[model samples]
Target chain A: MTVEAFLPRDTTALALDADEVAAALLDAGVQLTRNGSRGAFWLEPLLEVKVNGERIAFGPVTVEDIPGLLDSLAAEPADHPRYLGPVEAIPWLAGQQRLTFQRAGLGDPLCLDTYRSLGGFAGLEQALAMSSRQIVQEVKGSGLRGRGGAAFPAGIKWQTVLDTEADQKYVVCNADEGDSGTFADRLLMEADPYQLIEGMAIAGLAVGATRGYVYLRSEYPLAAEVLVAAIERAREAAYLGQDILGSGRAFDITLRIGAGAYICGEETSLLDSLEGKRGMVRVKPPLPAVEGLFGKPTLVHNVLTLAAASTVLAEGAAGYQELGTGRSRGTLTLQLAGNIRHGGLVEVPFGVTLRQLLEDFGGGSLSGRPIRAVQVGGPLGAYLPESQWDMPMDYEAFAEIGAMLGHGGVVVFDDSVDMAQQARFAMEFCALESCGKCTPCRIGSTRGVEVIDRIVNGERRDENLILLEDLCVTMEQGSLCAMGGLTPNPVRSALAYFGEDFG
Target chain B: MSAQPSSKSVIAIIERWKDEPGGLLPLFHDVQAALGYVPPESLSEIAGALNLSRAEVHGVLSFYHDFRTAPAGRHTVQICQAEACQAVGARALAQRATELLGTEFGSTSDDGGVTLEPVYCLGNCACGPSVRVDNRVHGRVDSERLEALLAACRQREEP
Candidate 1:
């Protein structure tokens, strides 16, 4: 009898001693294989026994528990207390409608054969058969929008790039996954790098661009290493560079490491940084699709957007189009994080209520306290009170409520959290990360912080509150990019939802 | 101006990337990777090679936080103090860390054992308070874990 155990080599999983567990499993004469996460974070150090091509899960496992688990699995795979039966059948996972993330948490991330076996590269293969126009049309048919918080239509961006004529064009993947509580980009890059590579290659094919780049942040050193290695492997396998799969087209990817700056995640700033300049935001009359990246037309997309493009091509527009609600198509890879019990990557289709994700998927707070607030998106996102938990995780739905589904990162906070402090932090973070491209953001953020500080210190709270609101409006209207523009989201939302905390 | 280790190596680094468009960042990265930090002496060399002014080179170098102006300590410890990490008591952890090291954020220890820096987020938000010791990242780092890590760095310090 052959038994195999798979563990996620992702950043979070490694931090939880998955590496130590892997070593321990090896010492016990158990043949182990490392794979991507199954999104079951609570069960991390999660081991899966593949019996007859079906995976049985065991987890939150320590080195001490390994011997007992191996013994029980040897006797009866289903008899172990730690075993959660069929891996896919788990209610938490089975309920999720994974489209873009279908290949995530599977076999070896780097293996070309493992990828092909699990429906990887099918998108590129399918895309290679179609003309650029047909590919763009198919994407348009899918109704997919940017998963990178902007909610811009992916097909429209592609169409514009395709329409534009330039001697040199580029497809740049925004792998600077800097949003707080978000790890989907990091997870995809580490677990399923080929998907991102294929997506970019497909975009290259569609846009008549031969060169590509993945501008990853320096904070994620592991992701950078994994992506760089994967790009090399892809190049060797003829999946990238010169002529791809005998398709008579040429495209290649380069990995550029970002110096620590949150502003660089902005498309124009990213392009500026890519040109080896200071990562400052640029005024945008010439959209990136028209003029970008060394003054050549460029298509800059977040990692998930490109990954989704790969899936849409592979599964056909209709297959992806069938999953999501309203304007939102396909699954949103929601990153469950912070002060949560079952926090991990949960990729579900749009329209799922926060109540469902928080109660059913996240399993409430990690501290076992009542979840008082949730911050959707990043630092720039709103601090939603429990009353808004029933709100759907849709782009338009979130916007309607004066909130956002920015990058689909849901950070839970328990009742013990101070809303005033969180609000102050919003201003402080803006003051720290603002690129100083515009005055409203540069000066207003510092002033906003002081105003909030005055309110916190109980110095004419009513007057200061009004002043802070007015300041937020000025910054929101005047800032060049989302960095300063959205800083007021958390501050204003906190004021609206948790006003008592201010007093 | 004082002399550099060898002008040939700096020229070689410049020559390698001079043909590639927008190659200054990678050039600086290579220089920093080979040497501990971007030495001030190489600024003129880089400026001449890239055909830019000294102020331009200085602007790029100072704009980024990664390119240290001087040599870093043996170990670089970056603790995440962003919102997600802060939710789980990273501020307290950061304060305790500074107290243990007898230095504040962005400062090297008195013994030059460790340089503690505060990063916004390490992208391990799920399991943070996250800390990066050199290139390796660790999550759920409490005061005890931090003390153990700092002690290890102290032990490895050159006598």
Candidate 2:
């Protein structure tokens, strides 16, 4: 009998010695297959084996646990200390509304056969039969917005690209996920890369584009390698190359790597970087939709948006639309990080509150202290206090509360956190990453940091606080892009919520 | 420090990627991968081959944080100083690294054994205090683990 064992090849898993565990399993007469992460990070290096048609799990495992694990597996698997029963029974994973990440941690991430057996390209097949207009209508009706912080309606962007008359159009996936507390894009790319590839191909057919580009960040070398292999396999299988799936439509994706530039995550800056120029933000008017990427009509979407596009097609617009609250439809891939105990990815519908996500999914602070504040979104996002934790996590809802859910990255902080210091770091990050295209952002960020320093140092605290607010307003209104515009969100939110930290 | 690639190899790298749309970034990446850093001497060659001025090539190279003019140390150790990592004591860890390696961030150790730098995020956020030693990312890193990693770097450097 062939006893099959599965282990994650994810970065976190590999860091915890999943590779060594796999080697040990192989040496002990077990067939080992490297799989993607289940996103229950606390239980990572989570080993699984096929038992009576169920994937029984044992995890947070080390090489030392192998002998005893195998002994228990042969006799009574429940007897092992690391055993966690069947994987599906784990409440952490079972609670998620995993649409885009449905097939994560199932089998070999590079295995096309495994992907096909588990309903991988069903959406692309559905799309192959539909008209571009009909596809656009389905997407528009689904209410899917860009998941890369900017909640722009994706269908509208696709419609504009389709309506425009250009010699050539392109589909660019902004995989430059530079957000600190977020790894959903990297996880998607590394675990189920074909989903992103399929989504990009669908975008190509919908927008009348023949080429695509995935501007992946250099930080994610693992994601880069996986995407490269996946794109090649997809092209070989006729899912990504000229004449995709015998539909007479041509769409090929080129993987581009971004150097360490946080500002490049901005679309225009990303375009400039892609064109082999300095990553400076461009003025809006010809908005990338009409004139983009080599001065042609281009459809740009986040990795999650494109992946969700494929999901919308496979699961139908109404089915997805029925899941979430007003405007915000379908699921939100909430990435719990920072000082959280149970830090991982949680894909749930929109109405879930911050408090619920923090308590239920994150399990509060990792340090076992009372949670003080949480930063929603990336560095530019606001730090909400405990009082506002009950608010829903929808984009509109967050915006109403002087906050914006840029990306669904919720970073927890314990009682020891200094809101004043966090506010300063926000300005510091902006000053470092500003593209220098405009004055307000380029100059204001540095001045803001200085002003905050004065306030924290008790140098006319009241006056400096007022001056800091004015600086924030100038950056918010005068800056060319969100790099300067949204820097004030965290600063103002911290000052407003935790004023004591300033003095 | 690693030896710089010859001009001929640099031109070959540029020639290989000049035709593709937005090929300069890829060419730079390939050159860095092969030569350890973007050699200042090769800028004129890259500019000429790509039909851009030397100023333009230099601007592109300098704008990105990744493209370095000088070669890095034998091993690159990047500690994540982003908010996610900071919440879990990355600041203290970075301080510990600086003290142990006897070098500040963005500087090579005196022995040229390790280059310590600060990285924003490695997309391993769920596991806080992530560090990347070369291409492999290690998570849940404490000061002790960091010291061991640095010691390993030094051991590898020895004959």
Candidate 3:
């Protein structure tokens, strides 16, 4: 049989190119099926070998090692080099409570069989037995909040969409994960794509919506391709069609690619983009549930939210709620990035401390420099000094330190980092990407950049510090979207914790 | 007389919708995707399409830093100005990039071989000092990188 290996585009970080290795293997007359990663960035470029009905995984090997690997495979070498023994044997993976990401990095991302093998469609199967309200309750009981920037409760958003008055409603999956450090949405969608599809189908069933749209970011073209294929295969399998699992429910899913705009990750902005308009933040109060996605009632959720929902419905609410800290139940997919060995996706409990994550699992900074501060969340997330490193990764925990688990994307910064520049970037990024929907964001961001520039250059240093704080306050409170609103975090938090840089 | 949405009338439409809630992005995307950037006449079309006053569209068109209202130089060169890239001399590299293009950020050069735009991180932080020519990303960019990038763009444009 011809062998195929599905290599991810972002696998450019690998020590070996998948294409080259696959080619060399092909030259050796060996068949290989390139499967998608399971959000395990560290294990990538993770390779798998088909051993009987089951598949076994191996390294993280480079192009040069392919010849030796193939030779050993032919000889059935007693001990394979770079073999972590087995993927399941890895403590990092075995330790994870993978409900939503169970199939990620474990199977062929596009293969429907691999998914079915791992109990993928079983959740949708179980979901068909229950009414819409029952499904909503299960999600609500799971305490599964939105895994996007804002950790809003997921079930409530569905309930509102269900309650809204619309003949045609929508379920929008915000896969536009534009945060600097966060790759959970991208990796999750790429690896466990079916989980998202199942989650959306369940949402469609819960909210009484027949149509769903996944607004995936343009930066992640491969994820889009894989998801689009999965969605199609799901349609053919009757898991996402007019009659899903003989439940007589009709749901159609479509994937819309978003232009690279950080603002579109916001719910309303995503709606506007979905409607083929500019990606700009909308005023709340009417809220997305009431007036969203072409002014129709819509259920807007992050990729992680939907993936988790699939699991919650598959298992009872109590099963999911049994895990995690108070108010924050269920597992979280923690993406460890930036200047760290073993940089990849990590799934841990909701209340795990940043110390255990960064130092223990992340293996500290890859730069070999001292750890100064870490920016949890994306670009707009707060720059936390070492003092806050002990803070747990939770919704309330982030708030205590003035940070957020915004999409659970953890970006590490080494000692060589300049807090002042990071703070300025927060403002500059706001100025660059701001939709200009409101005056505070449109103008205040520009002003904030100017003030930050003054502070960085040592011009009117003491006087400018006051201006910087004031500007941050205005941007934080007055701006319309999170682009401007949350941009103050890096600046304010950096100043608060690592103020030495300002001098 | 009911105004028709031609190239000229489109400008009026753009002006009208430019100030409405979330107008620039929808307006920008619509104009750019449809006409390959916000053309002057299409401004009114955008205004009419989005339901805003002409002056409002004009104000927004000028307010935001990213919207390009006119045709740009042949090659689009986006410089990395984000901190991760800056840590590796992205600022100095940006200067080299601008000098090679013979124009500053947000402007087209006289030769029109390149148009320089200032962008935040392209998510290639691990490979710092990154730049993008059109949609392609080049890592570890510097003065030599800028020249090489410019030359490559020139080659691609030719037969």
Output the worst ten-in-a-row residue range by lDDT, candidate 2 chain B.
Answer: B1-10
lDDT of 2 by residue, B1-159 (tens): 343445667778987998877899999999999888998888887888789999999999999989899889999999999999999999999999999989999999999989999999998888879999999999999988998999999999789
Local error of candidate 3 at B130, Å?
5.9
Better of 2 and 3 by lDDT: 2
Quantify all predictions' global Cα lDDT against the true fold. 0.87, 0.91, 0.73
Tell me the lDDT of model 2 at A233: 95
lDDT of 1 by residue, A165-240 (tens): 9999999999888888988899888889999999999999999999999999999888888898899999999999
Decreasing TM-score order of the candidates? 2, 1, 3
Model 1 interface DockQ: 0.72
User: Ten-residue segment with the worst summed lDDT in candidate 1 chain A?
Assistant: A36-45
Instruction: Quote fnat for model 2.
Output: 0.84
Best by DockQ: 2
Going through the candidates in order, what is the number of backbone clashes in each? 1, 1, 38
Question: Which is superior by TM-score, 2 or 3?
Answer: 2
Clash-forming residue pairs, model 1: A36-A105
